[model samples]
Target: MVKGEVCSEGLGPCDDTCNSKCTSKYPNGKGSCDSISNSCKCFYQCLQPKPEICNVGIGTCSTACNDQCCNGNCAAKFPGAYEGHGVCYNVGPSIYNYCVCIFKC
Candidate 1:
């Protein structure tokens, strides 16, 4: 979640000082962490962060996404279990599949 406010003077281009853990996905000075403003924002772009706080009855509404979703929001669409073998098995109608025992049930 990049805040809209960014200090370009002291920080130099965001790319140069980008925090890898915080702002690695974007290039071109995007995903800047504004220490003064305490917010993060991508340059010339808009992206809503995942709803960390969900309203009543909303059950943590899925994250705003474009085309294909990833990370947080992905659980909303494909609920399943992956055993590190790159296999995902859907448990039921909702997200979150039961983990299968490696040995046996």
Candidate 2:
């Protein structure tokens, strides 16, 4: 596994405060303040590959609906992607839901 920096927030100079904030956000990750950037950076082992955003469109919370809309659209747009590799997530309130697809880059 490779260690990766997932989050970084600038909070003035390096101090105990930066360490505390990083630990609070990621319990399993290490937080250190970089003097060069003057930011608190969180480091952790990234087991899974980072997913790339494939497509975003209107969709419902139902898996069937999302599968039809998101999977179909993602396959059409990115033909090289493996079949059923696209995953759709429903976000926003119940009144207005949107589909977001994350697939292999």
Candidate 3:
């Protein structure tokens, strides 16, 4: 049920400021929060691609995944669900227009 933009587990880098919740994952100056936006502030090196605003239908589809898939996109493949495994696929704009969840197994 996790929706919206998926955050990357990987931080910008040791040279960049990271999120407050995740600063301990990096060194001192490598992670901090911007008081205004209250978001992780990073040095220029941590710059990454912004999440894309896609549509449903053509870009629309649906899939489910485990914790591993929660943070990013996983290529479509498989015999579908295995055992208690969840599905992992793209969804539509109504439900979503991006990877909804990530998988671990």
Candidate 4:
């Protein structure tokens, strides 16, 4: 997975107001919305015990939700992803940096 990067690159449903766009320009997310700058900034972080391979950051766009957020098996759905996810845990200037497949939890 990629290190020192944010993965909320997808632009999801504007009405949903939960998962918005991640930071990467070429890569992607299944995500979480945090209160940043008084905005419900929705984005994705990588998940782990690091995968056997790496990442494919799916649903990192505005398409995941039409009415609401998309929920289910991410690995089973989006594959062949060329990009990588983020780090799981960090000690310097990074928190749980891994982007997980977002589902109703």
Q: Which candidate ranks first by lDDT, i.e. highest?
A: 2
Q: State TM-scores per candidate.
A: 0.17, 0.33, 0.22, 0.20
lDDT tens digits by residue: candidate 2, 8-99: 33445667787676667656657777654466665443334654232334345464555567666656654564232344443345544445
Rank candidates by lDDT, best first: 2, 4, 3, 1
Ranking by TM-score: 2, 3, 4, 1
Q: Give me the runs in candidate 4 sitting further than 4 Å from their true place.
A: 1-4, 9-11, 19-41, 50-105
Q: Once model 3 is optimally superposed onto the true structure by TM-score, how far is the C-alpha of residue 19 displaced, in angstroms?
A: 1.4
| Colliding residue pairs in candidate 1 | 2-40, 2-41, 3-39, 3-40, 3-41
2 or 3, greater by lDDT: 2
Q: Which stretches of candidate 3 lie over 4 Å from their true place?
A: 1-18, 26-96
lDDT of 3 at 22: 61
Q: Which number leads on TM-score?
A: 2
Model 4, residue 42: C-alpha shift (Å) = 4.0
lDDT measured at residue 55 in model 2 versus the true structure, 0 to 100: 32
Q: What value does the lDDT take at residue 56 in candidate 3?
A: 16
The TM-score of candidate 1 is 0.17
**Cα-based RMSD of candidate 1:** 16.3
